[model samples]
Target: MTRTRWKFARIIGIIAASILLYLLLGVKTYLYKASVFLPNAHPNEVWEYVADFSNMKYLNPTIEDFEIIEENGNYNHWQYTVQYKEHLSHWPYLPNYAKARFSIKPDESKSKFFIKSFHTTCLINDFLCLNSESEFSFTRGYSSHGVHCDEEIAYECPAIFARFCEREVKYQRDAIMLNLKRRFQ
Candidate 1:
């Protein structure tokens, strides 16, 4: 082939390779943090609901079952069922059962509670999901009459398609927080 034609082909090949690599191996994991604040809400009263991880059902309607394997003061090892109604959402969560160790720490003022999760299993058998954790805090917002809840999710998965969990997580979190706001205030 001519020199110019050969160079043009090489450049095209490189571009194609880069695109393929990005599609196959890129964005396998994601970290997201979200928060909601409600005015005219009681902080301690809100903490009662937020401190217990089992209370997730109050926020996430998709949770069909929640079982506590072990429990102590402000700490629990639990498993819960997640229902993915639509086909698009069900594929990634093959097993649909999740297990995690969650804990809560409340400040002396009782205005803030920190909830942390560790050793979380996204799928029943730990299939496609590699690692995941949700860190959440419920506190008093700018005013004593207001309540604030913050959540951070650090998730990792080997499959590129598994990253879809990020959007789902954000949506569910927002839904639950809004539910809490309406319920309390």
Candidate 2:
């Protein structure tokens, strides 16, 4: 093949690879849902169980420790310290310490509770790109006999961090729902 033709072919190959990488890493989305039966408790009673931050330790398996830092009007802000072990492409192993603030609102009429949290994962020494801010919103509904929970989480980070955020949210949500069911039953 001619040298000029070879150069053109190489350029096209590079462009195609770049496009594929962007699609694989650039756009990501995640959602998780779970529901369990309460059997005997009223919806209002169940909402109260999930709304109190102090009960988080009993209801959520992912939270190592949490405390309320401020309260203003209907918004109560709290800080949570979370520990999770994760693996990265460039790192052999990584452990994360994350701090987050949660804003919660309790709706008695609907027997629903809503919480929004903003947090940043701890930084790895060599991988600064993994440190990113994430936002998560959770909605939980209680009926006379059961409860339903749904959560949405979004993170703005490089492709790697985005993928991690998606996985972590699902994991945490599932853990919390499982714990809640165990305690209530």
Top-lDDT structure, candidate number: 1
Candidate 1: regions farther than 4 A off: 1-28, 74-95, 122-125
**Every candidate's CA RMSD:** 5.8, 5.6
Model 2 ranges off by over 4 Å? 42-58, 65-71, 75-93, 118-171
**What is the lDDT of every predicted structure here?**
0.65, 0.54
**TM-score, one value per model:** 0.69, 0.59
**Alpha carbon RMSD to native, model 2:** 5.6
- In terms of TM-score, the best-performing candidate is 1
Writing each residue's lDDT as its tens digit, candidate 2 over 82-123 gives 333333323425544555555556565555666666655555
